[model samples]
Target: MTDKLKDKIEKFLAMCLKSKSEKEGDTSIKVDELTEEQHREIAEDAVAITNSLVELQRLLPVSRKLAELGYLLEVQGKITVKAGEAYDEAALNFFSDMYGGGIALSKRLH
Candidate 1:
């Protein structure tokens, strides 16, 4: 990727992280009484993150790699007893092996 594209990717990833953090904070805030405006604000933030996630899925291979890793972690130990359960773990391991693990994958992609 060009340096400019790489910078854009990094900024996008930072936005993803920030959105996630904000969502977590919003969840906590939701316990308190919220006005309609506040509720709309929270909903809009969630929608923004969801839309960004969809865009990232299209734009970044690393996002897929990380998602596969998460799936693999969820299913790694139960492959033999349950093939369905193993799918996630196998996928995670496959991506990790394919890309030399998460850190390397992110660095190489960005």
Candidate 2:
């Protein structure tokens, strides 16, 4: 995909994620009331991200970077939740797979 298209897709995904995170807030406010067109756009963007990750997984170095990128994306998503914002699960899960189930574990002391 062209750079312009990729940028648009990324923005759409981010907006949808933000909308979801906002709904998780304690204030009990409704989401931003996105239009049907906006929802469709978000869905398309999610598909694009998933496809790109799949292709990137075929390359060793790129695959490694993809996993790290996934971790960063998940971290950003969690930060949005902590800030009382919303995030899309599709976007979160896409990265989760790349990062091997999404949570990093540390070894316990013996």
- How do the residues 2-105 of candidate 1 rate in per-residue lDDT, one tens digit apiece? 99987765565455445655977743332234466754665577679889989978856765665566665556752232454544456656656766755666
**lDDT, candidates in the order shown:** 0.60, 0.59
Return the clash pairs for model 1, or none. Answer: 72-88, 72-89
> Which structure among the candidates has the greatest lDDT?
1
For model 2, give the RMSD to the true fold: 18.5
* Structural RMSD, model 1: 14.1
Model 1 off-target regions past 4 Å?
A: 1-32, 62-110
Candidate 2 lDDT over 6-53, as tens digits, reads 788667666666766677753332234556676687688788888998
Per-prediction tally of clashes: 2, 10
Model 2, stretches more than 4 Å misplaced?
1-15, 19-32, 61-110
TM-score of each: 0.29, 0.30
lDDT of 2 at 5: 94
Clashes of 2: 10
